[model samples]
Target: MLSTFILSQTKFDDVNELVKAGEFTKASKLIDEKVKTMNLLHEEIFQLQFEKERLERIRKDFNKTADDILKYARKYYPNATESDLRKWEDDGSLEYKIIDGKKWYFARAASNLFRINKEAKKQKELIDGFKKDPLDVFLESYTPKVLDESANAQEKLVKPVTFRLNYTVTVEPNAVPNGEVIRCWLPFPREGHERQQNIKLLGINSDEYVIASNDNLQRTIYFEKVAQKDQPTVFNIVLEVTNYSEVNFIEPTQIKPYNKNSGLYKTFTSERAPHIVFTDKIKNLSKEIVGEEKNPYLIAKKIFTWISTNIPWAGAREYSTIENISEYCLTRKHGDCGIKTLLFMTLCRYNGIPAKWQSGWMLHPGEVNLHDWCEIYLEGYGWVPVDQSFGMVDSEKEDEKYFFLGSIDPYHLIINDDYSTPIFPAKIFPRSETVDFQRGELEWRGGNLYFDKWDYHMEVEYIEPK
Candidate 1:
């Protein structure tokens, strides 16, 4: 699919405004009228259909009512008052929208409240006995080991850890009519990356499947299965990969100036619209945060530190719903992994730093989850990993605080070196995920089957080093 299209601009704008105003019914009608009367390009029609799909996706994300959120909050704060809820809402910690005069909360708003609000977290720990997340616990123990190993080793890469991963996507029973072909794109490990190597697909449940070529940035294993009545259609792949820890030892003095004419520098630093545009807000914020920093690494560090300190991580709405993720994150004052990473990339790019997206699964022992981070290119040092959402480490040593800035743990399962890139075999409809592809995507002759229509699960086993 084409990355962009030129629609009937003024009419499309009206539809967009209607969708934004929660006038989806009107928006749908207008879209149909345009298709019938306007000489629209196929791409424009495709875009319009997605605009309709966007409305449905938004409905799903913002399904909760005020009462629902309050009830959920009362789980930890049984005496939680309406005023407290209102306060959280004002702070943007509890995501909600005043849709057509009725307040609708993001589906994860109740769960994310504690994550974004410090007092709510304290209350939860006191009342619900909340503990540190397994992922945080694992990172505490694992990061230090990698840093120590990298500090001593002559080579930049250290502590190669191999894992056997089983990933499955199940389309809910009758998601489509029985015997209809369900097309699936499962997230498979990317090839030809130095840090991620020895990728071997052990097996797949389906007898026939096409593993996307190494060049597909968003690499996927495509499968086709017929839906069965009352039974979920399942697709899975078991694969073994050796993921290595990357520790690029850098010296401030040795950092080289970016070769301005280089294509890598040009492509990444320039604005990619809909998300990475260098808006006035971004330009000003970058100036405020960077503050006359000339060194490329230091400039990146400044942007990273500012986001780490200011933009607290919160659960994000679906990527497709938001027109501009980076700007949304800035306005909301919080975002999840990919949201923060997008903001990070935008700021870095605005400041002439070459930054791009990297994501997959972070398989840290028992703490496996869909994750996103980015890599920034330095002239002499090559590209370095930066997990902006992980934030700064609580340590006096600069290296410890900056470990993720230049290094990555072996727990990473690098699936996409970049975001919003093509899926091999070329999907016919808009992807279930317009941005990052982690959970996998499905569709049939009917159309795209969204996240609500299916479920995804990943299981991992550690292989002992020889």
Candidate 2:
């Protein structure tokens, strides 16, 4: 009788049991209703909702078993083998879960592998006919002649461009309780950087918006709107910013080493958990990459070249959920811009070079998209930009080849000074994105809303040249 009582489980405990047994949908629905009844803190409620919702979504379209995934991979490419599938999944190039005692892979992951692997096999060259693989499509058309001919060192400063931006954030039709306040945060530019400045909020659709202090690393403009029963809650803002192109002429041999005791040196070299860290493998790899190089510039150059040549760009899993982003990239040999940036920073830091994270929008004439890059600190130069993703292994022109190593064009809409740092007015809930905050973060009293439950859109226009 005592054993029977011990074995008995509550309704909430049953949900946990179901989750452990890989019955995510059942578990999700079970605890979802009890969410309202549970006397939990706001953050606790938000995390519960977020986790359950994510589990259900992952189980929804990603129901294919191992055999099913293998079959799908073979369907697209006859050459695919069980070994290849296992390898990709382990490397995190493909993602999955264990459901009902079976290894299930996301349908999207299978499709990505099928499409990318198939095309990758056929390409000796990509984008166009070229002698070597061009670093980037934009780089192909760029030439040194574009620089201001009359500009000398004193006049080499970048002119700012007036960026007119229209940004929007919305929650799903019925994501939260009816009439509950949906708090939204939109990314806002800060006013500290020498290269990027003059941030002005020209207008906003929501009259009640709060701009965070200029010193906030991850600055945002907060807004609150009451969710309607069947309608989506939307927040919109319009702003203009001035951003200057960043460039630094380097004399590698004459450069001085940083004072090891300085705060800037100490802060950037120290490890930040989850993303930037020096694990055994990372430290070993850093040593291997650096070899005998004592010069920071040369060490940076070596690491940049190696990563660019090795890691081909691919769609990546969400950064918030990943444990160690730099290790993930280094081991996987494939990563998007942010992943590559983190890897570069980690390797640099491991070798006594200081580095930090930066992210914003890459405003090209054709498209505006989220992008990440890093800042490396040198003694005399202060902080210089380094974008391993914008590598120049293929470019023959010296100017075009080394352009992004320590400089950036004026097309950047700089957003976050540092990644993963908190924003103003402090969130009471676990953030939707725990790593890199770009699109925005949203939450209410009941729970935090994930990306699947919301949508965001951005538009950029050139108002004037500064």
Clashing pairs in 2: none
What tens-digit string does per-residue lDDT give for candidate 1 at 1-466?
5432212222467887876676767888888888889999987778877777777888889999878888999898888888978999988778887655577899999999988888888888898686776766776777787788877777778888889998888888999998899999999899887888999999898899999888888889998999999999999899999989898777877899889898999999999877898998998898899898898898888888999998888878888777788999889888999999999999999888899999999888777899999999988888899999887776677887788887888888999988888788888888878888899888899888999999889999998587
- Model 1 clash number: 0
| Clashes by residue pair, model 1 | none
Q: Largest lDDT belongs to which candidate?
A: 1
Model 2 lDDT on a 0 to 1 scale:
0.73
Best candidate, TM-score-wise? 1
In terms of TM-score, how similar is model 2 to the real structure? 0.82
Model 2 C-alpha RMSD vs. true structure (Å) is 6.9
Off by over 4 Å in 1: 3-11
lDDT (C-alpha) at residue 211 in model 2: 93
Q: What TM-scores do the predictions have?
A: 0.95, 0.82
